[model samples]
Target: MTADRAAAPAVTAGRAPAGEDFGVYLVTDTELAERHGHGVLGVARAAVAAGVRIVQVRDKTASARDLLALTAAVAEAVGDRALVVVDDRLDVVLAARHAGHRVAGVHLGQSDVPAGVARAVLGPDAHVGLTANTTRHLVEVAAMPSGTVDLLGVGVVHPTSTKPDHPPALGVAGFARIAATTPVPCVGIGGVELADVGPLRDAGAAGIAVVSGICAAPDPGAAAAAFVAAWDGAGR
Candidate 1:
């Protein structure tokens, strides 16, 4: 292990997970950010300033080098304002950590690397997350050794062009059904908006993850603040 990984805390079962509040998770979409005249890093900085507690740098199309560069930039931009996670890129996470960036961890899709393996590679303290849209998925994650995973990015809560291939939109009701069954914290994603925050929270979601709601907003910071207000108002 590198010095940074060696120095990282060992997060075992029974310990407090890193992303407990999860309140206002922001998943970046470069296209959406660019549409609003902000690069991913710029938008992330703005959102973090407005209470976005978690920022996931997700660029499926970028080259590995570019993604690493982007992740490092985001790590710098958010600083300690938010936990910086790279979506579906374990190598990038390791590389970023090796380079001395404060990338907290990674968010993996169900099809990506297994959480157990990710935890092993990232060491115990890395805040690993996984996607779970079905009851079976939830059960599988629940069965994992504790501390192997930190959070669940549960959804396609609504239809979203950002992930056209995502399984059928879960909608609020479907989302609630899945969220209710999970032991780990769930952040409702995919087409989520400010109005859905209270309802999703009421439905047992620990947080709300958004792309366009903030990334494409005319004012990213204000949009993020709205999400924060809605989440807090729900008493989460």
Candidate 2:
């Protein structure tokens, strides 16, 4: 049940069509999964079954080989059910793709390879997302050649322990301010939860990205379902 990468529709700045809801994005946390006695792939599969539309595999500590193996496993598990992306590791994404895994793209941070180089390597069809913590970052993204990137992962909406290096919490108001100015779809990450979905949507976020909210939960399936329910109820 691998996804047809060539046939997947593009996600522009505007809202996605119904059923292609990118409204609930899940970022995997290996540490969180370990704490809950679950493997990352298992949690991701359960989450996708419960309606998560996008899943980003982000493990800062795993070696390239381990990350590639994990990415491939996740691709097999949820490739048909959701968009499978790698976080901060374009090399892993490339390796996975070369290995015939159904990886959709990579989510890069400001310190990662520049978006232009990433786009050139990934080609036009691969989904490319970048993190933006300030208005300047958004402005830079907006100024990039059109189609250079697909979406913006705007963050630290609340203080999150998952990434100790995260910038200051943006809060909803700050998130709103940044989202309003971006021309691309934005997903609010860092400390987000089911309760924040509606307000995040109202603040112009195209989706909500969570780590512990689902991965650390006792029931990842139900947790992911709750997020989908909240997004659907938000009418975004």
Candidate 3:
């Protein structure tokens, strides 16, 4: 079910409608879930119930077939509860959506397929999130056509083992600097945690994307709820 062979559907079946919050984004890690004894599906089900507005299915190690299956499972479990996006893989997003599973979009790194091309391919209704950490990168996104990107993930908010090669850590101030330069909603990602939510929200971040924070939590739902609580409290 590669992108090239998948039917060019309008992604109508399971795509989540717009207007959902991006706050408290959850990026899953299969190994982390395994270590925590709550498989990816379990964590996704619980986390969304606790207000994780966006769920990104990011299993770097999974095969294309496996990833597509994972996306379908997550989407089915989430239903209309949250947007389910594939991390760094446009093809799987397409394959899953083609199969009638509700997959919202894909999150791509700067080096992945250009966001503009992705936009052209997925059409206006799809939700796309791009990883851009610098002022220059964000400026590039700003210049693109409207709806080319729905969200911008900027970070490495604090050093963590998740992405060892992650660019220099972008503290709230650094993240704020980059975030201020982009018009699209900026989601602070990388090593984000529960405590970082308010400061990030205060720093102009629209949301915070976490991996291990929720995946490896003693209780995934509680951890997600805490992050949502912090973000909500910050606005008061």
Candidate 4:
């Protein structure tokens, strides 16, 4: 279907596996990963090994082919240990999956391709996330068929250069207010840090997506582990 035509879920309403953990999401930036003598794939592997539940491939500078290669390589490297999603690139997701990679799906923006079209294109088995902070954006997702969007990345929890264009920061209380209005799972993103994990989770965030907190770290694995530990111990 065209990106603009009215779209519907390709199948029934779906949710991620009950066992899936949205507690710690790692969004990779090749440049940040490279800052400490690491590559995106290498960082991704390290994070996943540390119990990171989701890894999203999001390198703004990478060409289509390069992104596809990295996504596939990450999927291969991550194996079934965690889910790998392409940030705002449904094309690379399709290509990587076409090449027999296990890309879970994509995370798109309000300005990127419409979430509905992406939902139709990728089907229900795929996990689709749309960046949303405003209640209006959450409403947009609520209007779609049950499975049209499986996840929502909802914040700029703090200011971060990784996504200079991020929406106004949605601190824990704000995020919780948004989370309260929707049943769909939401992961807080933007400049989230290790210390933000437990509070975000406690505030009702299904997870907190990290960029510099892990990618630019001297040790991404340890960084990821700390985040995971914080999430696991939240509210205890």
**Candidate 4 residue pairs that clash:** none
Evaluate model 4: give its lDDT.
0.81
TM per candidate comes to: 0.91, 0.91, 0.91, 0.90
Q: Name the Cα RMSD for model 4.
A: 7.2
lDDT of 4 at 146: 79
Name the lDDT value of residue 160 in candidate 4. Answer: 82
- Among these predictions, the greatest lDDT belongs to 2
- Give, for candidate 2, the lowest lDDT window spanning 10 residues: 12-21
**Model 2: per-residue lDDT, tens digit, 83-108?**
78999999999999898888988999
RMSD of 3: 6.6
At residue 85, give the lDDT of candidate 3.
90
Per-residue lDDT over 126-157 for candidate 1, one digit per residue giving the tens place of the 0 to 100 score: 78889999878988998899878888888899
Question: What stretches of model 1 exceed 4 Å from their correct place?
Answer: 1-19
Task: Indicate whether candidate 1 or candidate 3 has the larger lDDT.
Answer: 1
In model 4, which runs have C-alpha deviations exceeding 4 angstroms? 1-15, 19-21
